[model samples]
Target: MSAQFIEKYRENAEIYTGSDICKQKSKELLLEINMPNGLLPMDDIEEVGYNRSTGFVWLTQKKPIQHRFTKIGKQVSYDTHVTAFVENRKMKKLHGVKAKEILIWITLNEICIDDPSSGKITFGTPTGISRIYPISAFEVEEDEKK
Candidate 1:
């Protein structure tokens, strides 16, 4: 219903990242960061190089690129250098802030994998596996402006 609520109920809601209110609030700050040369990076780092695909922008490298069928047999291209610049100054404002701490940051954690039939398997999910982004991650680089 509101920003705080949206940030709570829908941490990953499109409305949170792409809302009219969010646009107005984060525009100025968001526009200062560098967008990747072609597309946004798909890896975890301090600032998440995430871009909006359809709904709510997920700020994790864990996101997947979309693909479609073509003469080449379901081919897709992701340059990571062509990430779109947030031209709408209004939308640029919603860039930086500490995403609410979800599951406190632990140095390490165990990841469990369970097959529909099997019992379970445990693997170590390493640190830096995920990152919460700063607002500056979306800005355009100064050297990039030619």
Candidate 2:
């Protein structure tokens, strides 16, 4: 059932990139990134994009996007973007000071496998594969007007 919710990326014609997948571990990863220490309940997530040429996959949540008030009373929400992994916490250093607490930047590490025939996706089974970093923020101007 979970597999039905995932988006498929076709590599050639017969093989799917298998970037977006619906699995327990993938859900947990999204939940951990969304909330640290499991403080907030995990919401459903769906994959956004997969670059078959570069082997990159982007993720997003299925739940309603939440917005917050700015210091100037304007309502805005964070736009998340995942970048390549760096060991020295590059993302945190660059954005840690400006990013909000709810906005988390994390270096994701995992080996994903795609089943061309069955359309099943699999990731490495290790707890520490994904790590959380600081949150990055960019206000949506359109949202602020609404």
Best by TM-score: 2
Per-residue CA lDDT of model 1 for 1-146, tens digit only, reads: 12242243233334323333333323322434322221222222212223343222323222334333222222222221212223222122122111113434232222222331333222232433533222233223446333
Q: Which stretches of candidate 1 lie over 4 Å from their true place?
A: 1-6, 9-37, 45-56, 61-91, 96-146
Local distance difference test, candidate 1: 0.28
What does candidate 2's lDDT look like per residue over 33-135, in tens digits? 3322211122344443333344333334544333443433323222332222211112111111112234552322332223224422222212344322222
CA shift of 2, model 1, Å: 16
- Name the candidate that leads on lDDT: 2
Q: lDDT (CA) for every model shown?
A: 0.28, 0.28
TM-score of each: 0.17, 0.24
**How well does candidate 1 match the true structure in TM-score terms?**
0.17
- Residue 35, candidate 1: Cα error in Å is 10
